[model samples]
Structure formats: structure tokens, C-alpha cells
Target chain A: MAFDYDKYLRPGKLPHIWCPGCGHGIAMKGLIRAIDACGLEKNNTAIVSGIGCASRLPGYVDFNTLHTAHGRAAAFATGVKMAKPEMNVIVVGGDGDGTAIGGNHFIHACRRNIDMTYVIFNNSIYGMTGGQFSPCTPTGAKASTTVYGNPDPTFDISKLAIGAGATFVARTTAFHATQIDKLIAEGIKHKGMAVIEVLDDCPTTYGRRNKFRSVVDMMKRLKDIAVPVAAASKMTAEQLEGKVLTGVLYKEEKPEYTQQYAKVIAKAQGA
Target chain B: MSSPRVEVIERYCKGCSICVEFCPTKVLEMDAFLVKVAKPEACIACMQCELRCPDFAIKVFKD
Candidate 1:
């Protein structure tokens, strides 16, 4: 059968609410392609999102969607999955919503190795909240909240997820549309918790203040800074210092949380 | 091969014109405070306009 993406999109919501030159739209298309590639049944899919520009994704998608509170996408997604184990649950949110206020939940979710895919749209700023400093905001970067420059170090989200026990973790940029779609598709197929961090641009909030001439300039920067993981591994720390690594950073097989919980429940029932 | 085509939903457009300003190929134009696809042939199907519009008013499709 032929694949049609427009079927999944809400007709009236054609124009998304992200600022022009923002990277979220590219990420969204990547996600749609991934979902289509995986052949996931739209009726069985459930998307949960937190408050942010990225969180608005659930509303636009045709599947079962929930727009939860800020920084609680994972928590709400966990509940959705646990309640209906058959549902293919995916959590979507921005860097601040996923790595800042939702940081703790993110770690525990990874550690639990739940059967869910977490897609983080990391634009390095709190776009929805007026360009505040996000946990992933790079050091010395300027934001509306950080007039001088962001003094805090950025969180390497993929690395953090791998370290926290996610079964699969990948990193890609909005510029690498095909790669992003492939990685997201792989994440969805993984048995245990999977995390994909998509490096995106926030032109209005993050770009204007940081001196990005335009959206194209920001995309070019992403293309230049991104280094394939295979190539990066062969380089020295100094060589890789300022470069961003893209591709699957880690993957492993582990018993999923829901499956383990089912065993425990069976034991109790027998007892 | 030809490039991608961009469609702007004028009703949803808040006249941000970011699409016109940010398109790398200069595929979009601002006419009367509204964005119009001036150079659809230059689009790369990047979906940058769709992603960047705060109003969610744009879509990129192949020709």
C-alpha cells in the first residue's frame, strides 16, 4: 500500500506554531517518516507531550495524543503505556521540558528501561517560555534569560540517557532529515527504552540573540559541526571538542520494565 | 530534479515573515504582510518553514 503522510496530519492545523526558521518542523517530518517506515498502526499509537513548542506535536498528529503538563511528558507517557501495554507510546518534548524540569523523570525512565520512545527536540533554549536558559543551552550562549551569556554547561542528552541505562540512544540534527527518520524508526523498534535527541534551531529566541544571520546559516552550522559517530570515534578529544556526534551512540538488550512487572504480578497471583 | 514546493496557509500566518527571511533558497516572499511562495522551484524539501513558523502555517511538499 502507498504511504500518505497527510492522512496523519490535522488538516486545519497545517501551519504549526513554531517560529520561522525553527528546526522543530524538520524534526516533526522526520518523526512522521519514521512512524510510517516502522509501519506502526495509527490506531495503536499514542503520543504524549509536555508543555513546549515540541509538545504541540501531539495535537497535530492523528493518533491518540495527550498534551500533559510542563516537564511531565515522560511521567504521563509512562502512565499511558502502563495502563495500555498494547499501545505504542511515544513521548515528545523540548530540551527544557525533557532535560530540565523533567530531568529526574527522564533519568528514572531510562533506568527503568520502559518500552517507550523518547524524542527530544533540543533547540538549546526554552523556546515556548520566551528563550530562557535550558539545561542543554551551551555554555557562553546568549538567551533572553541570559542577557550576557549562558554560564552553565550544556547537558549531553544522548550520553546522559545511555549512562542512565537506556537500551538505545541516538543523536541527530534537523539538518540530517533522513538520518533523523532512520534513527527514530530504530528507536521505535527497540524493545527497551529508546531516546533520540534531535538538535534543532530556535531562530527567534536562540538565533537572533546569538548572531545567526538566518535559518539557513544555522542549518549550515549544524551541517558543519556534525560528525558521524564512526568518524568521531577515530578522532582525538581535541579533534572532536567543538564537533557534535551524530548516530546511535549506544544500544543493548535488557528486560523491559513492563515485562518485569508482569512477572512479579504473575508470581503474586500464583502465591 | 526539481526542488520542493512550499505552501503557506495565510489564515494561520501571523505575518511573522520568518519564512520569507529564513528560507535558504529565497523560496518565500512577503507580500502585503503575508508570505507567498515566490521561488517554489528553489525549495529543498527541508521543511524549515514548517518547523519555524510559530503559527504552524506552512508545509513543504515535493513537486
Candidate 2:
């Protein structure tokens, strides 16, 4: 079935701001497909995002979208979910917005295990800010901030989400469209907090600094390095050194925060 | 299933060739200014072309 993207997108927001070869659009479409598959009513869904290239997604998506401050998307989305516990709240952000400036909120949201979905477009650089090295930028990759090479270590977002108590977590690249759509839908369906880290491409900024010959080359590299979680389990640590692991990394049943909060309210009311 | 029918909306195509390069069946090709269905019979209806097009220009329909 073909997805009616026009129905989910803002009518006048055609021709987005992304560069010609950017993979953010692919991730956006994957998100739309996921939302459609989950059967969530557009009016009842809230999409929150911070400041950055990937964060601009909410501006184009037709939902109860909130273009929040630089690093406060998760915090804002938390409030949105708390107020309307039945609404589906999803936070969209880039690596810089989600992990660098918003790192604290990101961790707390995961630890809280709130009923929301967080999708991180891990393009590894501050694309909108002239290609500065971001928290998810590879250690040796070059960026505007690191002309020679990035010396700082990168954050494994999926692993971080797992360690921080996210009820559901998954990772997929922009090149894996089907997998991206399926995983995102699964994340939306999960009861508690779900963090899906999508490895997207910033061809104009990250690609230029990192010496990717073309968008196709960068996408091919992403495809080559990604290994499914099931296949990765059998491989030794040395063999899996540089491979990107995809599929659902972890999932567990836990009490959602809002439900617990209701309990507190009940106790206070002497119910 | 029969061969998939590929349609390229020229106005939306940016001539990126992402679809041509990523097509697993090698069914698409890049013309001078836009994409063309060089071998429609080879299309597998994977929808990779439609999903990966940054410009939302191409679409594939399976018969």
C-alpha cells in the first residue's frame, strides 16, 4: 500500500529545507509510514522537536507539532504527555540537539520510562550550525570544529538509551528504508519510552568534511557496515569492531511514568 | 507479481540518482535532467526508489 504522504505533511511546506542528497527526508518518510501503520490519529498525536536541521521535521509534519527550544524537546514532550496521557507524544531531534545540549533531558526521559517515542536522527554533526562536531560524531571523523580530526569520543546513542532504562530501543540507517519504517512502527507500538536512533546522512556538511565522494558512497558505506542484531550476536567482539548493529537492541516491560503519577494523585486524594 | 511500473515526477526530481544507485534490481537510470525507467521489467516493487527519493519524485506501482 502506498502511503499518502501529502495527508500527513503540511500543505504549504512542500520542498523542505534539506539539501539535495540529504537522508533526513528518507527518515521523515519512514516516520510517516510508521505513524500511519500504527493507526494513530494525526489530531491526537503530538510531535516535538528542538533546534537543528533534523529538528525542523515537525514544521513540515501535520500534527500537533511543537518546535521547541534548542535542547528542551524531551522536557516539553514530557509535559505534553503528562497533561494528555492518552495522546501519542513523539520527540524528534538531531544528534546535537538530543545528545549534546539536551543530553540530560534525554537521559531523564529514558530513565523515567514515560509513554512517548524519541527518534534521534544521528547524522553525527551539527549540520545546520555549519558542520560542527556533535556528540555522535565519530572520533576520527573531520568536521568544521575538528579540521584535522575529531578527538572527542562519540556517544553510542542506542547503547546509551539501553543503559538509561528506555523500555524499547532500536537502530537503523536511512539506507534501510523498510527496516527503518518497521522499527519505528514497533517503537510507536511499545508501551513505555522508546528510543529509535536513525543513522541519517548530512551530505553537504558531514559528507564534505568526512571525504565521502558522493551521497551514494556515503549511503553504500552505511549499508555495508550495518549488521542485523541477530547476525551480530554470533560474531566475536573483534569481528564486530566497526559494524553498525541494527534491529531492536533491547525491550522490557515496565510501569509507565504517567500511570505511576496517577497512583500518586490517587493516594493524595485518599482514594 | 508482474513487472512494476515506475513513474518519475520530473518537477520534483533533483537528478540525485539515489534511486538509480540504490535500486537492488537495477531497474532505474538517470537521464540528462531526471530519472528514467530504463528497464521497467526488472523492477521488483521494493519501493526503494520511492522511499529513498529525497525529492519525493519517483513512485513504483506493482501489477
Computed on alpha carbons, the lDDT of every model, listed in order, comes to: 0.86, 0.91
Q: Residues B1-63, candidate 1, lDDT per residue (tens digit)?
A: 556657777787767565676677888888897888887777787666665554556877665
Worst 10 contiguous positions by lDDT, candidate 2 chain A: A1-10
Cα distance off (Å), candidate 1, residue B34:
6.4
DockQ of each: 0.21, 0.56
The most accurate candidate by DockQ is 2
The parts of candidate 1 lying over 4 Å away from their true place are: A1-3, B1-63
In order of appearance, the predictions have TM-scores of 0.86, 0.95
lDDT by residue (A91-163, candidate 2, tens digit) is 9999999999999999999999999999999999999989999989999999999999999988999989999
Interface RMSD of each: 5.8, 1.6
State which docking tier applies to candidate 2.
medium
TM-score of chain A, model number 1:
0.97
After aligning candidate 1 to the native by TM-score, how far in Å is the CA of B51 from where it should be? 11
By summed lDDT, the worst window of 10 consecutive residues in model 1 chain B runs over: B47-56
- State the lDDT of candidate 1 residue by residue for A27-128, as single tens digits: 887898899989899889999998999999988889989999899999999998888888899999999999889999999999999999999999999988
